[model samples]
Target: MPHSPMEVTRLTATDAARAARVLDEMRASTLGGGRAKLAPRPAIRESWGRMLHNGIDPDHDFRTDLLSRDEVERRRQTSRLRHTLPVLREGLLSLADTAQHIMLVADADGRVLWREGSASVLRKADGQGLGVGADWREETVGTNGIGTPLVSRRPVQVYSSEHFVRALHSWTCTGAPITDPRDGSLLGVVDVSGPLETLHPCTLALVDSVAKLAQARLRDLHLTSLEQLRAVAAPVLARMDGRAVAVDKNGWTAAVTGMPYTNRLALPKSLAPGRCWLPALGLCSVEPLPGGWLIHPTGDPEPPLTAPHILLDVSHPRRWTVTVSGQTGSWTHELTPRHAELLYLLALHRDGRSASTLADDMFGDPARTVTVRAEMSRVRRYLGAFLDHRPYRFTEGAEVEVLLPEAPLDLLPHSVAPGVVRARAAAGGQAWVERAQR
Candidate 1:
């Protein structure tokens, strides 16, 4: 009979060799369809299940082709993580080098964009095919620090034999995911990795704390940009006549006149200078500002007479969006992960869901109604009258459409919401499961 699972972090440095041996036995027993004397840690076990479901080979060290150098440069230039490089380097590089580990940052798509730290470990990582431009997604490469945290959306450490791939048993890695604070969009993950002997209990916390600092730096930069936009908006809005507001490209409000101050405006994906219909502001004349847009209410600020059409697209694993069309015009808004989950759940349960019900669907905890309500309020700002409360649902008269991924496993890959998990499970793991069995 197998003993209860052991958390790798609890092991002392002197127990490193023993811990690896035990984990090895646990992994072998689990993978070979036989029970052993030990069980894997919760995160490792869950990650291993995903790996098996996806048909990943535990013995074979599979890796996708490295991205071209030019493509790597292009991604680095465009990634939001580029802006926080200084913060990450300052916080992690020195410690990583001293500990003989390497610090690497992978984009939301799991492509490594930045790498630095101990010279010797860098060479070893190169041998492991973990250099810049490498793909580290869990499906591509068996569960490891970089890819696992991206899916789990939390800090994680894969120590020695805890790694899903058998060849990775000699290494250890700790990583934490970083997200955009403004809208809760995942940016990427920061990871510190080295030979198994260097594994330390504190590494996970250190990586997580530095990742938060990077997020704080990004937030500060956003605030500074908003301040600059506000400076330009104040003067222009002061001269406007009727109800108007100044908002950034992402719909963050900077100034308002003749109307209540809104924190955000929900701009369309392809907004331009002209007459446009906004959910919150209705028919309006839009003019380009320095770093944002100026809006003046034109016709009635009320919704159109006919019912609107809403299309919720969750086909892509990483990006989700909602498009709304009415008699006046059409607009699409990119959704944050949490908003995506709520909208998806509402779309699934067209009859409507109470705050507690939504909480249960999202978090598997009905007591989290306060959090559900807070998120729903933000969703309503852009959705406007199209979404109704007191049992949140789309308006009775509106048309709703949902676009799901072809493969069940691809549906919201980052989401572990109980509802989404159940939906995916209903598909019986689809193609990947078949591929793995073969």
Candidate 2:
């Protein structure tokens, strides 16, 4: 039925006639209100054999082999949807520079999580196919991207009339499924809808980019949940993420910070910007830093690279802050909303809160423990980037706390500060977090 080169050769005249006769008779049976079994009924075949005064040719046939287009479409959908998180609505307002319609995120049972973009554009988009609370799966609404991708566990671009819904002929959608890497499960989907005429190859990529950004953010949540890290300061900063038992030269976690959580999580850029701690390398190594332990031929001899065992040595309980450099952003310039959020959080809780406690008191929607750990890490990373007296870098067995800025509201955006709240409950509790209400 699709327009592909994978068609079979045409049937010969005699065969075509026979096919016509079979189909005509089948149609007549239905029209005349008589049931005609297509199987070899002796009388039916005899009648057709006689009616076909012309001899039937064996050459006539129809082609059926296809190039497995389903796989092509399926893989595309899977890849696109794999990592994107649905962008949640924060306030009553929507973001600028997007379709004028609202997009919703839902679980398998069709419960809405988040939705926002352009309300006017969304209303028109709804007419094309999607609508508030409407399911978009192949089973429920047809072979469109969002619902079908969710069902199929992939990214999908349902185009033109491929949709099963007659009301969706004018629509096309590109959708990708969001996934949680810590446990490797489907979180939901992110989809973009627009007119078929405006479709371009970049369209899907944009949706894919958003998904990746969201996934990156999601992964950050996971990292923030890991409250402890093996901060071994050798030639290279080795951040070993084994059980506390495997820490130190003896490989025994004799001293542990009871803030219990997982060890292995993604490394956020804020924590290790220019440096990468390779777990496979066994030995750690530092890079060419600006100027610390410099050995200039003409200048005084610089201090030797700090020893790795310093982290475990009781004589030096505080490991020298390994200055992994090159994190440059809003600190030298203006602060972003996220910058404000991090600064606010750090400012509010000068005393380090446990990763779990931070999730409980600071955020409105609760991320999984893994996600929470990553966000905490992000919170720390962001503070390190902006604040003059950035608090603790990262270590296991203890909570990190930052001293709030003296000018409390300095982190808030001068323009939008009044409209924003200082903090909200985590795990999707605020009025804005509840999508169905919107």
lDDT of each: 0.84, 0.36
Across 219-307, the per-residue lDDT of candidate 1 in tens digits comes to 89989999999998898778778898888888888888998887888878899998988777678898999988988989655655477
lDDT per residue (tens digit) for residues 294-327 in model 2: 0101122332322211111111111111122221
Q: Which regions of candidate 2 fall more than 4 Å away from where they truly are?
A: 1-102, 125-130, 228-438
Q: Residue 282 CA error for candidate 2 (Å)?
A: 27
Per-prediction tally of clashes: 1, 44
Worst 10 residues of 2 by lDDT: 310-319
Model 1: CA > 4 A from native: 1-6, 36-39, 301-307, 429-438
TM-score of each: 0.90, 0.33
Give the distance in Å from residue 333's predicted Cα in candidate 2 to where it truly belongs: 48
- State the lDDT at 358 in candidate 1: 86
